[model samples]
Target: MEKLLQGLIQFKETDFQEHRQLFEELGNSQSPHTLFIGCSDSRLVPNLITGTLPGELFVIRNIANIVPPYRNIEEYLATTSAIEYAVNILGIQHIVVCGHSNCGGCKSLYASEKEMQSIPHTRKWLELAGNVKEKITAMNIPESEMAKREWMTEQINIVEQLKHLLSYPFIKERVLNQTLTIEGWYYIIETGEVFRYNRHNSEFELVN
Candidate 1:
């Protein structure tokens, strides 16, 4: 927490002063071109990863970066609400769903229910991995290679969320009208190689 405070001070003294006009314009209103949805993992900094300055990308971070399907409910979810505002209100042109390698939450997908009992909320959140589970289970793969399998499933999970994103009426309409484009990405933190899923090729290819 002290480190965060120090960083805040540094931002005020250096980064903020250097970008005063940018912050001033942002203070009035924002017109970000992309909505980047990512995980709460400390290593995953969307701005640094994309080399995007403030006001360029509106970001939503959640545990495991899960995107629950559009649903009618009384309560609100930050991830869904962010998507609504980005797609419906902000009119952002691009939405990127990015999952990363070696995610603890993704690893938990292989745990038994009893093993996951302690982290009930986490287990609940990761239930979205059911789609990934179904895919992984049917593969004639070895347990020794489960982690590698999960990495592939992590990308599959991103596609699952993309399908969920399209379930929203407004998003579907906008997407059909070519007003928006959805991209799935996987960032290998260890290698610093970002892979963008090519829908046409149905494979993740090097981003650059």
Candidate 2:
């Protein structure tokens, strides 16, 4: 609590003053160009990773960075609603689904029922990417190869969420007309390297 308070004071005295003009301009309205869907992990700072300013990225963050397939149900729908507002209302051009290495949510997909019982809501939310585990299983990666399994799971989850984004009619139409583009990114927290998914190659190539 004390650390956060001091950080807030520093932000007000230094960072806020430095970006005062930009903040004033964004005070009335914001026109971000990209919708960044990323994990809620503390290590994964969207702005820090992308080197984007405050108004450049409209971010939607959640456990595992899951994007639920578009549904017409009447409910709160936090993630779905945010995606709709960014694309339909805000008219954002690009959507980036970023998943990072050593993702706890990705690992939770493999957690036993007993282990996940405490986080029932999280367990349910992760069902959106439930098939991720199935894909890993079919890959036949040995349990001994923990690192490879983790890498595959994280990257594959990013692709799966990108697919879920296409399930939205508005997003799909814009994509078809070349008005919008969606990409998957895998971030290595320790290395500070990001790998962008290449659909043609069906692999994640280092972003140089």
Candidate 3:
């Protein structure tokens, strides 16, 4: 907490001052180009990695960077509501669902039931990855080091969640009309490299 406050003080002294006009403009409203849905992993800092300024990206971070298909129910759902606002209200042009390497949430997939007993909510949340395990199983990825499996699962999971985003009527319709673009991205935390899944190649390729 102290470190964060110190960082804020530094920002106020430097970045905040240098970008005063930008901050002033941001105060009125935000007109970001993309909605960045990424993992809540501390290592995967979207703005820092993308080099985007404050108002350039609207962000929603969650465990495993999950993008559950939009739904309407009696209860209030934060993630779904955020999507509704970003697409319907804010009218963002793009949505990027990002996952990162060595994610603890993804790693939890391999945990024994007993190991996960305490995190019932998290286990339920990761039920979102139900199909991902099947995909890996059908492909017969050899049981190997935890790190390798987690990395592959993390990347593949991003693709799956991107599909989840399209489940929303608005996102699907706008995408069909060519007005909105949805992307699946993987950020390798250790390497500081980002890869975008290329639909044509069906593979993740280096960005630029």
Best candidate, lDDT: 2
What's the best-to-worst order under lDDT?
A: 2, 3, 1
lDDT of 1 by residue, 1-208 (tens): 9999999999999999999999998998999999998888888889998999999998988767788888979995777888999888888999998889987777788889899999999898898768887887788679798767978778888888788889888889988999899888898998888999888878899977
Instruction: Show model 3 residue runs off by greater than 4 Å.
Output: 145-147
Cα RMSD (angstroms) for every candidate in the order listed? 1.3, 0.7, 1.4
lDDT by candidate, in order shown: 0.87, 0.95, 0.89
After superposing candidate 2 on the true structure, give the runs of residues whose Cα lies further than 4 Å from its correct spot.
none
lDDT of 2: 0.95
TM-score, each model?
0.95, 0.98, 0.95
**Which candidate, 1 or 2, would have the higher TM-score against the true structure?**
2
Better of 2 and 3 by TM-score: 2
Stronger candidate by lDDT (1 vs 2): 2
Model 3, span 61-166: residue lDDT tens: 9999998877778886888899889999889999999998888998888788999999999999999888887786576666665556677888889989989998
Mind giving the per-residue lDDT tens digits that candidate 2 earns over 1-208?
9999999999999999999999999999999999999999999999998899999999999999999999999889999999999998888999999999999999999999999999999999988888999999899998799899999999999999999999999999999999999999999999999999999989999999
